[model samples]
Target: MDLSWLIPIVMTAGGVVALIALVAVLARNLKKVPPNKVLVFYGRKHTTEPRHDADGKVIEAGGTKGFQVVTGGSKWKWPILEDCQEMDMASFQMKPQLKKIPNKDGVLVNVDAVASCKIKSEQSSLSAAVERFLGKTTQEIHAMVLEILEGQLRAVIGTMTVEQLIQDRETLNTRVKAEAMSELEKLGVGIDILNIQSINDDQGYIEALGKKRTAEVVRDAAIGKAEAEAETKKRSTTAAKDADVLAANNQAMTFEADKDRDVKKATYDALIKAEQARAEQAGPMAKAEAEQKVVVQQVKVDEERERANIEVQKQKALVAAQAEEAKTVVPARKAAEALVATAEGAKKKLVIDAEGNRDAAVATAEGEQKKLVIESEGNRDAAINAATAEQKKRVLESEGARDAEINAATAQGQKLELEGKGKAASIRVIAEAEVYQAREVGKAQADAIEAKLLAEAKGILAKAEAYAKMDQRGALQLILEKLPSILEQLPAIVEAAAKPMSAIDKVVMIGSDPNAPAKFAGNVPVFLAQLFETTKNLGFDLSGALKKLGIDATAISGPDAPKVD
Candidate 1:
């Protein structure tokens, strides 16, 4: 009876429940994409518009079984018509450790690197990333990225040597990132930062190389130190020698200065004495000049008297000569004129005769020259004809003689060859016999020499053994004991030198110095000192030996001895 009122109440409640159910369904379909995430809705009949590519080319899209992507924004799913998924777009760091990877040089190395990777955020990249990594956890994405990075890193390391890996880490990182990004791009993954942290090898080659470089540096330092020390010593020695030379030069210069001073002093004294002598002789010289002038005047008066007498005699002789000339000159002049005219006539006659003879001689010489030229031409022709004929005869004779001689020589050569062969055989036999005899004799001599050498070697060995056993003092005593015998041979030294000198006819000591004998005597001691020095150099220590014998070694071989020049 109350059914109508209950029906209205039930319908109102049913409507309210239906509204709440619809709101809940709408809320469940809505999704939010955080700044670090991307939302992807994929199902049938998507409502997303087509996107323009980087070149602004339009793509036909929508109304297809495809996915819609929303990055850092909100997106709604059309319940049952589409399903939604979220992809982490946030960057995460991954450490990729590649172990025992062989490089270009086939050296096994381990590489460790840190990389930051995320899903691509670009429209096309985001669509690609949503298709690949949609609904994946951050850890799972990190693992996938690490694997890709490690594979790319191994590929990069295989292209480089351990040295390049160690020295060029930046290049390693760049190449690894490039290769990794190329591969990850297909998976819609991007690499933001990639860094190679360390590269190492199990082998100790790098340590050894460092050690070798350090050793080389040490060697250079040692060589430099030695060279510097040698240079310093050389400079020191040079300075010492220079000081000695300078001191000697100073001493010599001092001697020269003393000598010059003495010479100047003597020269001044001599000049003063000469001036005093000149002063003392001046008055006497003046008086002697006055007396000499008086004598000169007297001599001049005597000369004038003699000159007057001579003038008188000359005047008398002149008068006599003038009279004689008057008596004889006219006739003599006439005779000379007659003789000159006759000589002139004879000269003309002789000149005419010479011309006639010259013409006759020239004509005769022309005839003789023509005759000689013709005779010479005839003789030359005859000689040429005879020479030609003789040459032909001689050639024929030489041909005949050559043929005969060749035949004879051939016959003689055969005979001589037979004889030479016989002689050679005989000679060979004789040489063989001689060689055998010589070999036997030489063998015998060699045997004897070998025996003698062996004996000598044994004796020498015995002597060496004995010497080795003796102390230094014992050896010196033995030397002292044999000193007299050694001295007995000393006369030979004098004789050896004097024998050559004795063969000379005379000794000519020709030197300008008066003290040559003294100098030669002085050189004898120097020579003796040099001789003793030579004996010491031969390991005898002659001065020490002499000192042990209580002899004064200083005279010849001690510190006081004269140095050899």
Candidate 2:
């Protein structure tokens, strides 16, 4: 009975221990990748990853071969088939120091730089990193990166001159990064940053360069100061002459204007006087014409009165002759009738007497009528002569007055013409004088400006010579270093250039395009292209710098970019 109980207890105890050991082994094999590390599981491998078609349908249940990698996750290793290892993904800082590296200028330079590198997180790069850096300490990783970078830095410095090394370290840094990245990629190492800390030469070349630059700058400053002073003196003298000439011109113009005003005033006064005299003459001439007309009418009335008197006298003479005829003829006829009735013999003598008396009366009446006709003819002739004489006198007086008026007008016109000629001659003389003064002043100013411009051109030529000596890449790198500040100021420059648009109160667009304003605003991007183009012209290719940073310059400067104008 005791033996049977012991066997069950022993078997139970053995089963529990085996279970605890299995749990311990399983826990140990289940590895979790650290946040800053990669866990690689190696041993039994597969040929390929899982494959898919266009529609994502599984074409093959592919498996990984050689080694499988995990970054920041947990994975259980096959107990007998696979083993797990952790690779440090943490970054390490490096200070690569190169001693007496010979540069392109044949000068030995020592360069010091700081850099940070880490194992790449990309699958291919991580696999490459896993092969070399597996189980490697952080110090070992730092040392490896330092060796790669220092070699690259040496090569980069050797390609540059002493002046470039001092003035353009950024170019050195960029080339080092570009060159080192190719070598480091083999070991799956990536450079986060590479900056040159210091550069110096054993031969004291940099100090000499600095001293030479300082002397050049001082010489340029002195020359600039002298040129500026000379220019200032020339400008002062020119300005004084210009001021004097302008004052003289102004005074001449004022005198001419005053003289013109006075001449015009006199001309106007003469015209007014002439018109007033004409007006005065017009009234008197009209009155004289009316008086002449009245005289003509009075002459007509006197002629009419004389004719009436002549007619009245003729009528009275006719009446008296008729009465006489009636008295003589009637009495004679009555006497003849009385004699014929008394006696035949006495009737003949009485008839003869009556006939004689009738004849005498008829003759007397004819004589009276003839005398009245002669008197009427004389009076009518006298009246006609008087009227003709008055008319002739009035016509002569009118002709004399007209001739006098014409002479006065001709005299006034000649006086005005002579005065105008004098004034014109005076104005011409003054204008000629002012023109001469202006030409002299302008010529002097031009001479001064030409001298100043020549001086400026000389200074610019000197600067251009200095800039021409710089390497294109080094200049570009310098520009790129300041590119951030330049970009920051671009908006301000563009806004300031467009400031005139703010002064416009209204814009009247006359085009078929509705996006005119948008296109106008889009010029800002085009201005960026123009700025880049201008930099390129100056041997600083900003586009090349942008391309190094993995930016597509073509995309930034598109084909449809608006023109700045």
lDDT of 2 by residue, 262-281 (tens): 55753454344334433543
- What's the lDDT for all of these models? 0.66, 0.69
Q: Which regions of candidate 1 are displaced past 4 Å?
A: 1-3, 47-65, 135-140, 210-565
TM-score of 1: 0.37
Cα deviation in Å at residue 461, candidate 1? 99
TM-score of each: 0.37, 0.42
Error of 2 at 416 (Å): 99
What ranges in model 2 sit over 4 Å off?
Answer: 1-35, 46-64, 78-81, 265-565
RMSD to the hidden true structure, all candidates: 41.5, 47.1
Output the number of the lDDT-best candidate: 2
TM-score leader: 2
